[model samples]
Target: MASTGERDGTGGTDGAETAAGTAAAPAERKASWRLVGPGIVVAATGVGAGDLVATLVAGSRFGYTLLWAAVVGCLVKIALAEATGRWHLATGRTIFDGWRSLGAWTTAYFAVYVTVWGFVYGAAAMSSSALPLVALFPGALGLKTWAILCGLAGLAFVWFNRYAVVEKIMMVFVGVMFVVVLYVAVRVTPHLGDAVTGLLPVLPDGSLLYTLGLVGGVGGTITMAAYGYWVNAKGWTDSGWMRMMRLDNRVAYLTTGVFVVAMLIVGAELLHAAGTAIGSGDQGLLDLGRILEERFGAVTAKLFLIGFLAASFSSLVGVWHGVSLLFADFVERTRAARAQGTGGEPPVLEVARGQRERSWPFRGYLLWLTFPPMGLLWLDQPFGLVIAYGVLGAFFMPFLAGTLLWLLNSGRTPRQWRNGPLSNVMLAAAGLLFVVLCVQQVRELPW
Candidate 1:
């Protein structure tokens, strides 16, 4: 295998020509459709039920006035994803390692956020995944039972299978959900003039915040940060894989962009025209399904529900698996430090050898996300937990963008792979937009 540094063209102990010579043989191997794996899964996983609801509500409330926002969101995600993949390929380091370079502060923040975020997210995700199932198969199983089953099934799927198998499963769900959503959008047949106007790039009165939210919300989550790990897992760790990575990122976000645009069309033509509003929670999706039944008939409603179930369940599994990897990586790093005695001689050799080994803390955090949060499904989540989730969630996008900017521009990466002027501009703009949204989130907090 070509070392990551050589593949990235980041001249180190090895030179570029030698790296290229090693990678050239693999480069000649014909690329297959099957290689487009984890990117699609990560993208599909990132755009969950909450994202669907958010986009739908935006369309219903603002019509296609925010279509541009959705497009912008896709662009921003592409930039972020590409940067992340670049870091992995270039530095031969996972995103966790990249973040650690920024400072201990970054790692510390992520440590707390991952734990708190996973616990709450697990229950919420499983419950949301369960709602459509409960609606479809009433009395067959209680909601909590279904939720637990979904969680366990997801856990099992990831625990046993490797990356390629999991990617195939997620891609199937992505296809199902994508087709259903596109079909619904086609059924609605939104106004061309209104959609064209929405593309004109102007935020209307009283719509600035909604525009920002729509743009920022487009197919994003902590899992977006997980893209690098997925790429690493796929064995795409060199600059030779750069073209493939870019292609993967492009296709994933293009699909996601289309999905969001379709939802916007549904919102604009169906809900907005009918003066209908989706409710605020996962239940809101159930309410929308009923409305679809009334207007379009039972088949259409069922299809929509299927799409919802796929979206929710796929995301449930996606987060369960992807975040677990991240948690594991975080814990492994922490444990290595502890094992070496802080002020004593470093255990650099042990840490290096065990860098990829799974740690107890990783599995512990996974269980933490999967089990303890089951109680919260029955009761109100603690105020502190909710507040922390909200705050950390808001900060993630900016944190991701800013860190990518810093890393990509740093001496750590090869100059050829560093952010070009155009990429930097897009990333900087994304960073600014996310910063503004983060401020809004903080300002709007109840406390």
Candidate 2:
């Protein structure tokens, strides 16, 4: 692939000079078809075991009635990830850099949010990943032991590897996830006629909140913003890679749709048809595994459990690497400004160097995500912390959507790359949808 500056005819920003007085390196070229890894990583990360269980529960409750919501959710995420990639390529800036340009308040919100979010998320991810492992090898380790081990393993893998290695490993796990979920989907004996009819946008009676949840929660989170960082990590730093990046983003959500819809199929065909209800949370998956074992034998249940581990573990390491890269960039630019005694923006190249996966801040956050959260695994998660996590998490999607609206439509973006009417409409829809969801989440939180 040719660099963005070379292909798009837009040169780098004039003042983006490194401390050594060199211009930022131009974006490089690559085949758009071949640039598929970053999206895979994002997709795999976003749809962890929670997403699957949620889809399963939806299917069990409403029996394929909300299948359309899953598709819409993927479309919403596609729009968000595409706009993020466009901003990166068109402006040759990191998402943080753009957020910082918005104001110091943006930085402040992100700093506190990331720190608190990572603390809670790391333990949750490890335990989720360890669930299937313990199920498959029950006598081998306890849940807390397996969770701690999973956390350490993720930290080690991310700390030792770069973006390329991380992408490759995520893809392998995604393969396992696809095969097992798809196999169960095919075996579920779906009602083809009802599924076809579900393509229509009908909200079943009394299913408004559940339908909205499915539509808004399909395959998104802060990991959506991490897509741009992954694009840069893959060395696709210019408008030249925009087409490929969009394609990759679409592929990510498409894969996510498949994972989600397959779980829906399992829920509808197995649980709904049998009048069985699974419990909530990751344990719901364990409940499903037991049912699968009784019906299809131990081999099938083991395979699904293995797939579950792959899905959760992919999120663990992906977040370990992707979010850490974001944090490291923040540290690098902040310290660079302080050291220069000028509050001016740090050069793009300066932030680029800090992208090294082995950087100190990267490893520090990795350790933070790995070790501290283990406390929550042993002692129950504190009530206040869970409430705070929910509050911060609720606003993040809107924060991303509203900020993208500002960044993409403003002078910050190139004229050719600004959001078209359709993009704006979709983003506006996403912003509104998430705002409602955020309010509901806040109200539902037991303060």
Candidate achieving the largest TM-score: 2
Model 2: residue 105 alpha-carbon error in angstroms: 1.2
lDDT per residue, candidate 2, 1-447, as tens digits?
223221111122323321212334345455566669899998898888888888998899889889998889889989998998888877766777778767778888999899999999999999998999999998999999999999999998988778889899999999999999999888777888988777788888887787778878867878888888888888777776777888898888898888988998999999988999988889999999999999999999999999999989999988998888788877866665556564553433434432457789989999999999999998888899989899999999999999999888876676667899999999999999999999999999988
Each prediction's Cα lDDT score? 0.79, 0.83
Which number leads on lDDT?
Answer: 2
Model 2 scores what on Cα lDDT?
A: 0.83
Q: Where does candidate 2 stray beyond 4 Å?
A: 1-31, 340-349, 352-355
Residue 4 C-alpha lDDT in model 2 = 20
**Which residue pairs in model 1 clash with each other?**
7-239
Clashing residue pairs found in predicted model 2: 1-29, 1-30, 2-29, 3-27, 4-240
